[model samples]
Target: MKRKLGAEDLFKINSVSNPQISPNGEEAVFIRTEIDEKDNKYYAHLFHIQLATGTISQWTYGKERISSPNWSPDGQSVAFLSNRDEKNQLYIINKNGGEAKKVTTLDSGVNSFLWDPSNGKIWISSKIKSGKTFTDKVEKEDKPLPKAYVVDGMKYKMDGIDGAGLVPQDSYSQIAVLNLNDESIDQFTTGEYQHSLQAISPDGKKLVVGVNRADNLDYVFKSPLLLIDVETKEETTIVDQNGYYGGAAFSFDGKYIAYAGSDHSYKNATHGNIYIYDVEGKTTVSLTDGIDSPVGDYAVADTQQGISSPAVVWTAANELYFQLSTMGDVRLYYATLDGAIYPASPEGEHIYDYAVTKDGKFALIAVSNPTFPGELFNYEIAAGERKQLTHFNEEFLKEVELVQPSDISYEVSDGNTVYGWLMKPAGFEEGKKYPLIVEIHGGPHTMYANSFFHELQLLAAKGYGVLYVNPRGSHGYSQAFVDAVRGDYGGGDYTDIMAGLDYAISQNDWIDTERLGVTGGSYGGFMTNWIVGHTNRFKAAVTQRSISNWISFFGVSDIGYYFTDWQIGADMQDPEKLWNHSPLKYAKNIETPLLILHSEKDFRCPIEQAEQLYITLKSMNKQVEFVRFPDNNHNLSRTGTPNLRIERLNQIVQWFEKYI
Candidate 1:
């Protein structure tokens, strides 16, 4: 008998990502991630696959997590980053498979890296302190054991996977070149600004870097493009810091460089565009000027840790490909240097990551769907034949009853058609009424897409029908639609969701409207709080890592000060406006029983946001419960410790089961 996909299945689920195709396209290397439930940790190992024979072999084995696997241009060696030594260091292994050798030993772990084909050199971006060698700085400074922080600047500390509000830890990430033969490191760029390695010219003469040199404290939005001479280390600003830009690549002949970016004309809701820069002319032109979709995956998730999605994938000097979010999916689009573009992958599936062959005849795509975790597929570029190459979860999935969501649409008040999906309860029977849970997504800007979501699946297994929607202000829509909820929070956005719920209820007789519950995190959490305050239609609500007061969020959150201004259109300058939109202002009206779920160290929407709402509701004699997870961040649901993740899902399911 088939069993429902429950919370414990998280341990059985195996996922693959970051398929790096060799130069000859004969083989590929990708990372396979599995949850170590016994230790409550996550682990990843590199695996190699032969394209012709479909033969697979493990390349590395260890407790350390491996990421960013890159094939050498000559295809003789592969390099990747690992945390075997407690800090992320560079490791290289032969193509034939043998013991991996450590390439670099830096006190500050490598954040990201790129390989220079012309020379056996590696370019890395890492955080380094000033005035001392990184190792000496760490040792001599005797970093204070402070439970308190002396906060400084608009952006002081960052939210790591660990926790938040810990310390005012700051470091400047700069570029460095490491010579493999001599093992000598050369620091190229300097300053307080952070730099990221983007791309190297084909001849390895020029390097492209994304540098954020914004002078003002409040100007945290721009990252300009910089071209550095590999030898002289001289830098030229190819693109001004008037906006954000990165993911750069040079043409095969090294005449033009292609990059992705956007001018902040629309602030946080601006769609990204592709641009080409002529090295000789020193001029840049936008290739995708009128496209309504974001250039890359703005709808992000913490599904797989240590995996990165490249912004632009160039198949040729004249032909390039990139992913864009549209409707409820992130689709791959092929474009020419002249700006013509069309979809390259299937329309309805999410392309998590992809690798193209040198001749551009084939592509290795990492794709996922509503019922699929993630799998690799080989696609013939010309014939459009997509063949599944790997089935990591085939055995486990075969014995489970997975719920498939029905794509639905409804017209909201603003005349825009909102897209959503209604997932039936697992092992459903016709005409049987079931409890409903209206699940909301975070990013307020990010959308619910055609991807596998473990939480929703687990909830469905508990016999709850899940309703999730891409309302206004979601990424996978038009620029105007995404920007609609910025200045007008809790206005039309709320109506769009309610309208979707109403539409779903009207269409399905099996939905027990009286037993409706709601839950969401981050912005979704804020919306859940908002919904309970405005209406008591939900019998139970769980708000996770949510925002309650914009005023305090502006001060405590890692991105608070500026994100408040960018998203809500109000900052410290406008207290009344911020307060008016805050759900805390209306907390006394909440009648539904609320379960507040928060991470003690969530710097994005600090846990204090949850505290304010919970305390306010309790003060009003409302039924409320707050649960705090220690050493977790805003991504508690997606990337927390495996044990905590299972517990979180169980809590939500049990809460609804008890109340609804």
Candidate 2:
């Protein structure tokens, strides 16, 4: 007999990411992440695989966590970043395996770095105090002490950087070149502005960098791309500061540049589009104008850290591939120079992370589904055949009876179609009534897909039927549909979710309507609060890291002030409009047994959002309880401390079990 997935099973799962195919397309390397349950921390190590033999081997090991593994141009050495010396610095080791040697001796560690096209030098992105000779000053000093922060901008600090504290707003990120032969560093692109090197040209003469030259008032979301001359130290604007653009790269021939970003015409609802720039013609074109899907992995992944899948991968100068979030799945698609788009992935599986070989013959993808966790697979582009390469979780998966969800669709009041998934409880029986739990995803803009969701599976394992939907405000729909909820937060989007639930129940006879529960986090949490206040249908509800008052949210959240203006169409200038959409405004109407879950250090949706709702419900003698996780951020469900993540899931499961 197989057992249902439980909270503790999280410890057994391994995370795979950052697959880099060798130059000859015969081998590949990636990072395998694991959690030390006793230490409550995560570790990442390098792993190698041969495409022809499927033989896997570990390259590096120990307590140090490694990331950003890359192969040298000649495939003779592997370079990566590690925290072995208590600082994230660059390290390189031979391909045949041996002890790694440190490359950089900077006082302040490197954030991210990339190998040069010729493998002669490397460009590193690192933070340094902004002043004259600041790079040299930091190199001479010991571990610098914490200084008082005088914040002057709305985008000063964030939660995930170093836990719960305000960060230094004065320190700027600078790019430096390290000569591999001489071990000398030359700091380039200096000033008050911050620069991040994205890609280098094929000849290693020019660089694509994103620079923020604005003063105090402007946000850094729309930094312009600059083409920097490596030898002359001169800069030219490739894409100007009129819109949001980043993740830039030079094509194989250095004639064109491909980047993933968008103009902020629709604010938070704007779809991320892939734009290619012609360096020679001085023109740009959007490759995914009609796709209507987000041009990257917007869906949350449950991993040791928040892993970002590559936004664009170049197969050739004329052909490039990118991942798009459609409905709930992140699928791979390729675009040609003549403006043709086609799917490059197997159907019904989410390509969370992928990398194409230099010859464009094979692609290594981290694929998963409702019943499967992450696994490495090699996809042949022309033959369209996928072969499994890594089986890190095969043993655990074989012993677990996971619940597989069925795809569903329904029409809302406005005749717009909504997509959703319905999963029966584990060991489900025919004609047996089961309690239902409506799971709402965060990023009211993010959609639910056929991906493997650990939380949903745990809910199903605990004997509750699950239903999750992508409403009007979600991606993977029309642009008009995605932008539909910008000004009307709790209006049509709420109706769409409710209609989806009714349709789900009507289609399934075994769902017990009276024993219904609902839960969500972030924007989804706001929707859960909105649903309970507007209706008395759900027997129980749990809101995680939610927003109660948009008025206060404007001043507190990391992106609160501008996010309010972008998503809600209101800011500090319009307090009344902000309050009108606040869920706390209708808290008096809530009678469902409500459980509030929040993180103490969440800068995105602060703990105060949960406090206000908890206090309001308690003052009215309403049934409510509040739970808080210390030292965690808004990513508590996705990438929080491993034990806390399991506890958070248990809290949701126990709350629904008690009330339903």
Candidate 3:
């Protein structure tokens, strides 16, 4: 037998998403995403488990992949959106066990669905029927039609395991209403407006929807929330609440609306605020004011989802739950909404999305760390106790070694204190200096928290010190901290990182700053590009799945068009601001050995972004090389081919060894 690579040796698992607590809170239903090595496809399935005994009652089967399981409020039936027909559609399964009833017949297929609160209809949204699907398809006008087409609701363009879908062009699941009993569907918010930001009240009489009227649709943060009456389908905008608002939900009683949004009135700062909008009285109050970071983020959980956003649940009552990240660890917190927000912090390594039971006694939280893949946990909030539920991968412990990161903090650029985590070599010596690789995270709005990351640990295992930071614009800190990076791209954040390198060298005389290296993906990648151009503080750099040219990104990336408008507050058509913010603008200044890692099929940052940077740097005679993962998309880090995953690690280790 052949020895397996570390990643292959380690058991790999991912989320099934939205493990719904049964309405009664005594039972729960969830989807489990597992890899089928032989079939070479990711499969997700529904499983019914009693909350008390922890024994599961399997629901769906066969080679067909089913996902997005939503339990009806009554708990007798489950409604899920499946692509079993190749054409995704809504299907109903009963708790008592029976054949699933396919609900609708549409060509483009249903992308998203919601259980109707008042009636038995399923609210669904799809871009299939709205227009013909197209994504850089090069077809001759005289050739036969692509099999992905359908005369009505039949042909589905799924090329692989029927799950890894086509890169979403204009096709996305919007918000709408579908009547389950009569198989009737009603389209809401017509005329070029996508009901993207949407949530239905418990009574099913109201919907809080976010719509982007801007030509740049990806400016989700700039989109405004509108209150719609389910009865009349009438709309109203709550004043003093304009900006980007999504992930909105109605309280169990429907009196207030809770959502994560930012104050768009100001251009320089952004922080996701938790707002409670009084529907009848028309009043909006911002929660987490002093505690929130200026740069806002997005999260979602429906009434059916096991855990709703704590920003929504905590304000009304006393016990509130929310997700927070500082450094690279993402965890869940149960706060006292009544007083000063005091976090009921979890003691484990990582606590991500969580749910509060209807009885307000229990919670189903997602937990994971370096070696521990995502495992389900059941907690009793009052008792201050928790129990592990689903063991996604138990055998991982048998073969692989998990790396643990120690949290580190240092002052940067300004007087601002920044946080990060450092992973030393497995057999690290206290007095010896080692080559340090600095890592940055994406989401300029998201955070790098205490969680399990294989790549970082593998680098440490390869005998290198790894440092990752949550510079300005990262969440979990106060709003001012996150908003600190708004229009100041390479300005403060770059300095913060440089200061961080100095601090790391100071604390760990073991760190060899002269042989130091830096790298990141997405926004982190953008920062990597920015860092190389601005300062040669590190000896080597690797920019992965990153943004090199914002000017071109505004035109090519899937969300770049709108993202450029909001992040820079300028359109790409104008070369002024976009070029100024682009890392490519300063490519000539790059002195570090820059290696570009990218995915061929990436749309989020696009493969061209990497090509542009590589070409520019090589042309300028700077030490640069480009490596592309064929057939891989933007998510190569988290989900990609097993061979490619190990290869990715190998390339990084080799690059740093050669140059750093």
TM match of model 1 to true structure:
0.97
Off by over 4 Å in 3: 1-5, 9-11, 14-17, 128-177, 182-190, 212-221, 238-241, 265-269, 294-320, 325-340, 347-349, 429-433, 534-537, 558-582, 585-591, 640-643
Q: Candidate 2 on 209-302: residue-level lDDT in tens?
A: 8886777544556778988888996888878754678888788889999998878778767889999999879799898997877788766546
RMSD of 1: 1.9
Worst 10 residues of 2 by lDDT: 132-141
Q: Cα lDDT of all candidates, in order?
A: 0.85, 0.85, 0.69
Error of 1 at 101 (Å): 0.3
Which lDDT value does model 3 have at 518? 90
Report the lDDT of model 3 for residue 451: 62
lDDT tens per residue, model 1, 608-635: 8988988888988999999999888878
Number of colliding residue pairs in each model:
1, 2, 29
What TM-score goes with each of the models?
A: 0.97, 0.97, 0.83
Indicate the residue-level lDDT of 545 in model 3: 93
